[model samples]
Target chain A: MTVKELRETVKSLLTEGKVDLVIGWGKGTMPGTSTPVFIDTAEKADSLIFDSTCRNNLSVYFTKDRRALAKDDKKIGVLVKGCDSRSLVLNITEKQIDREKVTIIGVPCNGVVDMKKVVGKVDGKEILEFTDDSKKVTVKGREFELTFPLDEVISDSCLTCVRRDAVEYDLFIGEAREPGSDENAYAEVEEFEKLDSEERWERMKQEYSACIRCYACRNVCPSCYCNVCFVDQNDPQWIGKSPEITDTMIFHIIRNLHVAGRCVECGACERACPMDIKLLLLNRKVAKEVRDRFGSITGTGLENKPAMADFKEDENQDFIMG
Target chain B: MIRIEKERIDEFIRALMETWSVYAPARDGKNTLFAPVEDPAGIDHGIFNTDKSPKEIFFPHSEVLFEFEGGEIKKVERDARPIAVWGLRGCDARSLRLLDKVFGSAWQKPDNDMFEDPYWKEKYDDSIIFGTACNEPRSTCFCNWFGAGPHDGAGMDVKVVDTGEAFILDPVSEKGKKYIGSLKGWAEATKKDVTKMKAAAKEADKAMGEVFGMDGIQEKMADLFLKPVWNDIGAKCVNCGACAFICSTCHCFDVQDEGKKGKKGKRIRIWDTCMFPIFTMEASGHNPRDMSKDRLRQRFMHKFSYFINNYDEHLCTGCGRCVIVCPVNLDIREVVREVMACEA
Candidate 1:
């Protein structure tokens, strides 16, 4: 949606006091990415715009502010994409947010390019305007023409998304678009899998070897909801925070295992990592395997039990038992 | 109980693998682990025990309860089925029964539904463990502490004792009865199969190590708060939670808020340990276990005392992974022995 269109909707919602706050995105203090903003008034509503860097899921606020709600009165208006709305459905299943309490304004996302990726390509150049129509993106007054491929560039989830249309929403801001054909969602994992078992172990060891345990990945995951993490429990420390490879190994493996069938694959943890780690590869591996085995994808058929929650008569773990 | 020749073991396992996820000790070079295998033939039968337990398949190291995101709360979704741990030992299998008592019952403190974890339900719901006799017991193996041995089928779905040509499948649970019926290749029990299996158990019994025989571990723990020994023992202990990570029974954890500003990101449950100095620290910056000594005392007391009070079972499974993994080599058995020796 256009900047003016987004602002008008926010203003309309605020004027009616239909919501306590209109959550949106704005430019960040960082060089490329934008930060999340909670627009409670009409004056600030004008700044709410949909941009390429406005990539992080804004739906997280519904969960963060849940404790602040008293007996009544909580109507949150969210602007979401097809992929983002699927999380809303999964969120409903998880009861992270009340479905009736949310008012969703669905945006038909073509795809959003990560500013970090563009910035990395341009060697720290500034982006002036990332025209959605122009596959040709202008940066630092230089025109770079390119076609958007669903696999290599757009949100990785669109590759495997069963809900290319809005899963749960009150209104559609635009007509929905079909997700591109099945992408090689597991190509990276496939590459890792093709190696000898020992090589895969070494690869995992190498990847997790750099973990400093700041928990940026865990803190940023949309599905990683817990009030008391095992890492923080002292009475029986489940896993240590030691920076050593073995502790780090258990941490990374257990982290992935815990979220095996639950991860929404929003790329939040991978994006939030300061260490430039590919945490998504691990999480996506679980998603890929779950999909391959169950022939069911998360966030689709929102009413269906999560992959791990309910089992079909024929549960496939042939890979596991073999 | 049923009997099948040792050479026919692979066929029996393969048949079990059709309906069950066979988790057994498998090796990929140096790292030996208990993993689910479709082809039970690949596992080296000589490997007696796994470095890791089958506990994670039943009671995960970490798991999410539910997520609160974007002013919305999404409950964690899980649907579970049955998994069969093929080579689980007597000690670890018994530990699961203990864990089931804690998580399966409806006494949740803070109200997290991970108590009904889908992964746990799927694998453990109708679990049919096929335990094998530990022919070569490790120095660390101490199933005897809990009134068990290499051939003890206390909690196994089925116990297999190698009778030269065939394995005598001694069914320990109702689940084991159905598992044996499905095996067509196994010969009906001959007295010969039963006798050899018994002979193997008798042979293993001769080598069983002395049990710790420690008592008053729970009785003395109430007075541990007054004890001055926490300092000396906790000094050697680093706050790394590795011991809990490798433990067969430690089940503590915390949740994380991960996501965008408006969206509640992933609410994740991850492995946590009490060994960290700030574990007992409140967010307001007041730490209950201000010094490491208080933290150290809490760990021992909880394992031996508080858990017993609540569940009528000691938390430790006596797996000894903690002893080998502890950087300082602080053995938990030593801790138990020392606590028993200390004056009340």
Candidate 2:
């Protein structure tokens, strides 16, 4: 949808007292980025924008530490792309948020740009200005100007995203397109699986060793809403606080398992990670397993129970019995 | 002053590495950070500012204070040689000095070594800091806000300026002077080179533009401690430690004990931040900074008010790492402006 329509819709929601707050994306201080903006008044609704740089999953506000945003009978209006919508649905199914209190305004996303990929494309030049026309992204630096196909710099998750439109929304701003082809959804995972076990372990170690234990990945994740995360539980701490390879690996593995059937594949964790760890590789692998084993796609339906949450008598038990 | 050709910069780094364990900005996977330089060719001098700050060179993310085995405590050993950092920006150089006040000496009692941190002292006390002039400061850079510029040589042994074809290294400290005197095959910096260096510094300072007036920020922060401005300023914060972790001057850390069973363990200190809710949680389940806004307020207050109250300087160096990495884009620059504009 056009940004004008999105703003008008949010304005009406606040003006009509339908929602107390509208959470959306605003222009970020940095080029090729957007920040989550909380709009509470009709006048503030104009700050909302939906573009490739709008990478944050605004649904994260509905859970855990941010639950106060929806407290006191306040109806919250949230802008959701496909992944964000799934996160909201997951939150609702997990009983973390009341669906009644949220007004989901779905924006049909083409995809979000990965700023790291863009920077890499420009050979690490400082991007001063960034503009995208959906088909192409143009970045200008002090000495160079470059334009590239949108697909080239789009987030890795977006390349494999089966759903690019919200499955559940109170008001969808754009026309809902059919789900994207899933033929190449697990292509990267399949390639990763082809590697020998030792090679995979080495790759995992190399990737996670770079982690500074900042917890940006965990903090940005909507699915990771535990009041006291396992990593923070000092009473019987599961892993060392240090970014030791073993501890970092265990943290990632446990977190991956924790969100196995619930992960929305939003790519927020990977994007938020300052270390630029390839977090989605393992997450998508677990997601693929969930999809294959239980025929479950997370957050696609309100009535569906998470694969890990639901138990069936006749479901596949080959792993347990074979 | 000493001069080294731009193409032979690696040889200079290699020379420094012979005596000191050199740390420089280098490519580590997708990010550039300060890493140990065994091969001088691996050092990347072209980066504007590293993705992660050079603070990790002195104060690592995690440091084992001591290891214990059946009541016998063993201190972690380090290389006898001191450290030498290459290509640190002015902001990071200043950050180290700011941290040194806390770690190098007891601020309240200048003569007392009782409050000094041994681990930080061991690494940083004798370290030679090579402050590089940031000729092309990024848009987010605001070192000028804190009475600093891209070329401010506040905490450097040697001030290194890239004058296109060669580096003009000016000795700023006694150690730097002696070190430069010892180095061989380095030419004396000519008048033209000094002029180029000065011109570059001028252009970079001009590029930094206007400095935010921080005249009464400390007082304003104290006055607005219990005000609603914090709620507005912290509305979009995700309560992540990204900003604190990436910051050059954020020095808070938490110590934890790890063991195999209860027989043996090592006490380790890891980086911590007030951005986390648990950072201020009490044993009795009472948290002074329970809300995200409260934790967020503490970060700003400590940076602007409490640190200034203690050390007569703001804790922030305005390196702008937080400005770039914030997922929600709660820009600290805008927050500072908002705080300044707010009425108590």
Candidate 3:
């Protein structure tokens, strides 16, 4: 849907007093990026936009420290892509956010551009101008101008995303398309599994060694809503604060487990990572396990509990019994 | 005036590596960062700024201050060779100088050596910094706001200008002059080369466009400490350390002792940020900065007001690494403008 329609929808929400604030994407200071904008007044609604550069999952605003934004029983209107909508549903099921307090304005998604991938395509030259159509994305720098197919530069999570439209939404802006095929959904996980244990460990070590331990991935994640993250606890100090490979690995592994089955594969964590670490590989692998063992997909419905949260008599017990 | 051909730059770096532990901007996976360069060919000169600042060279994200076992404490030491950093931008170079006031020298307590950090002094004091001129400053760069520009040579031993074909290295410090005198295969910079460097500097300075008026920002920030604008300014902030971790002048660290079974332990300092709620959390479980806005305000206040009051300058160098890395796009430039325009 056009940004005009999105703004119009939000303006009415604010003017009609349906919501106190609308959380959406606004033009970023830099090219090929969009910032999360909070529109409290109808006039501010004009700042809202929806496009490939709208990478942040706005549902994070409703949780943890940011929960103060929705204080005084102020209702919030959040624009959500397919993955974002799933995160919202998970928040509702986890009882972190009230379903009644939020108006989910779902937008049909074409997938967000990974700026890292774009930079890679340009061989790390600074992109001065960026434009994208439905079919292709173009970037221009001083020395080079390059264009790539939209799919070529979209996030890897978006490539295997089964749902491009929200499963649950208060209002959807455009006609929802059929869910994409799940055939290659776990393709990366399968490839990861192909490696021997030693090779897998080496790969993981190499990837995670680049981590600077900024916790951008955790902070940006919608599912990681713990009031006091384990890493922050000083009494026992679960792990060392250093970015030593062991400590970093522990942090990532624990975070992955904490968000397992709850992560909607929004790619927000990967996008937020300043180090460009492949954070999604382990997350996607856990997601694959959840799907395979529990016969469940997270955030598909308000009624469905997370795979880890739910219990089933017929569920696979190979992990425990083997 | 010394000159090194663009093709022979790697050779010079290799030569420096023989005596000094060289760190330069190098490709680390998809990102470019200041890393130890064993292969000079791996150094990336194309980047306007490294993904992370050169601050980590002296003050690492995590550093072991000392290790202790069986009632004996041992200090951590580095290799005998001093640190040499290549491809530092003018902003980063100035940031190191600003940091030196805190780490290398105890500016607050000039007569005392107790306040000085030995780890920082050991690496930073004797280190040679090769500050490179920005041929094309990025849109986010705002060193000009702090009365610094792309060609600023405040903290450089040698100021380098990349004139497309060759590097015009102007020795700014005695160390740099002596080093250049000792190095071989370096030709004298001609008058044309000097003219080219000056033109490039002018173009880069102009490209920075306009400098924000930061004349009374310190006073403005102090006045606005209790204002409601912080709510609007910090609304989209996720309270992450991305900005602070990437920042060059953000030197706050937390010291922790890690031990295993009460046998052996090491005291280490890890990078910390005011953006995190736990950074201000007290042992009694009471947090002074309980809200995200409070934490967010602390960062800006520390950078703009507190540092300015103490050091007579803003802690920020306007390198724009924080501008690029903030996940939510809480642009510091916009926050600064908003602070300046606030009615407080």
Candidate 4:
């Protein structure tokens, strides 16, 4: 949907009282970035917009209290891209969110550009306008021209996505586009298998040494809505809270494994890593293993139990010594 | 059935040494560790179990999937080495068979979109194992709890029993038989040797064994998952996860990716534990097993119930490595007994 049309639709949804609040995108005071805003009144609904600049996954707030007053009810409306919509579907499959409680405004996307990359290239100029057809964006009247190629600028998640269309939604805004290519993501796993013991460990240590344990990745991820994280528990912390290499390693490992067969490929973890930690590799690795072992994928349908949820009688262990 | 004399084990070692990386119980300073044997001249055969199992020989504490430098990917190349663990206690050896249910039998797919592990393959493939029967197991051992004994031939490539100055070697598989036969220094054992070995195993089993209440331990463990005794028993845990780390069969792990500015990074899989607080912690500060009691429950249930549910076998090897290695004296034996006390 066009940005103008999206705003009117949100305004109508708010005025009709079909929803308690319409969660939409509002332009940041600085120009390009879109901050998630709850339009409770007609006046606030005018600020809603749909553009390449609206990149944050609004679904994250639905699981927690991002748009709640102490006394107000928390019914929410969200603008979802294809990938974001998949996350919503998976969350529902996981029972993290209820469909009747959410009003989804689906937005078809070729790909949304990463703001961090755009900011680095923008060189301090404020972004003014972004267009879908021209695939060009104007930053403070300076035209930065580009054609649509998802791999270079879009979130890494959209690069190998098999679905470019929203799986489920209440209101449709735009037409679905073709999916991007299936880049051979498993190539590195094969390469890593070649290393000797000492060399393999040395390299793994170097990679984990950069983690700061900020938890930004977890907070922003739509699926990570647990009441208590194991990392912070005191009485019987399965993993320690010291932020040591071992603790960090255990944190990522258990986190990924718990989500194994259920990670919807949101790419939020990768985006939130201030250290640029490739958390998705952990998720993708488990996802790959889950698919290989069980022949099932997540978010495709709500009926499927997560990989670890219910196992088959014949789960493979052929290579093990018997 | 084959037997090599205890005095002639050196010949067997010398023969097997040619084709495989022969690992035996060796002294590292004062603590016993498993390592590759360099000479048949120096070996210590006193211990029934090594302080740590031979898991490190296959699954190391850590391994790299790939490396990243200046935004370009460099995959870690595997070095070729065939592995053969000597003096593998049946409890430790049977654990490998259990490990195969998760790692060996079936993993769903390729690991990552851009990764597949070769390190796991290299160690798992082209490997032969030599396990010894635990004639005189420790009071702490509970291998019988998992349908195995010191002489269980389920997972071992070959079985070894020490009878005074002689060592008996028996193959468990066709490959094992061929490999044992090809080892030139060893002699073909006679029926008399097998009879002597059986008697020795019986004497050892009668004297060294203790009643573990196995039929009750697994069911009791499942029933006692939420018991208060777990808190009293688990409260001593510092959550260092040293128990899981040193465990002969604990197989939980983590994966890492070292990416460049614009390219995909290397993905790695490393060891992990459920005892540490962060082991269940999510990115959003939510932990399902937020209480130590809950994590402790997971540790035992995974060993007794969940693992059995998954593999139709208890995850514990009953080798008691976790019991011995625990720094705070968190004995799994105490926990099991405590679990047995629970009504469920």
Assess every candidate by TM-score: 0.51, 0.97, 0.97, 0.49
lDDT of each: 0.65, 0.89, 0.89, 0.66
The deviation in Å at residue B329 for candidate 4 is 2.9
Summed backbone clashes in each candidate are: 88, 0, 0, 58
Weakest lDDT window of 10 consecutive positions for candidate 4 chain B: B107-116
Name the docking class for model 4: incorrect
lDDT of 4 at A314: 82
Interface RMSD of 4: 21.6
Q: Give the poorly placed runs of model 2, Cα more than 4 Å off.
A: B106-114, B260-262
Predictions ranked by TM-score, top down? Answer: 2, 3, 1, 4
RMSD of each: 22.9, 1.6, 1.8, 24.6
Candidate 2 per-residue C-alpha lDDT over B38-134 given as tens digits, one digit per residue, 9 for 90 to 100:
8988887888789999888888898889998986889888788999999999999989998998888626474554478889989998899998989
lDDT of 3 by residue, B81-181 (tens): 99999999999999999999888773757455547788998998889999998989988899999998999888899999999899999988898888888
Tell me the docking grade of candidate 1: incorrect
**Compared with the true structure, what per-residue lDDT tens digits does model 4 show for residues A138-199?**
44424564333334566666566676667677887767565543347555545665688787
- List the candidate 1 regions with Cα displacement exceeding 4 Å: A1-322, B64-81, B105-119, B261-264
**In model 4, what is the error at residue B155, expressed in angstroms?**
1.2
Clashing pairs in 3: none
Q: Measured by TM-score, how close is model 3 to the native structure?
A: 0.97
- Give every prediction's interface RMSD: 18.7, 1.1, 0.9, 21.6
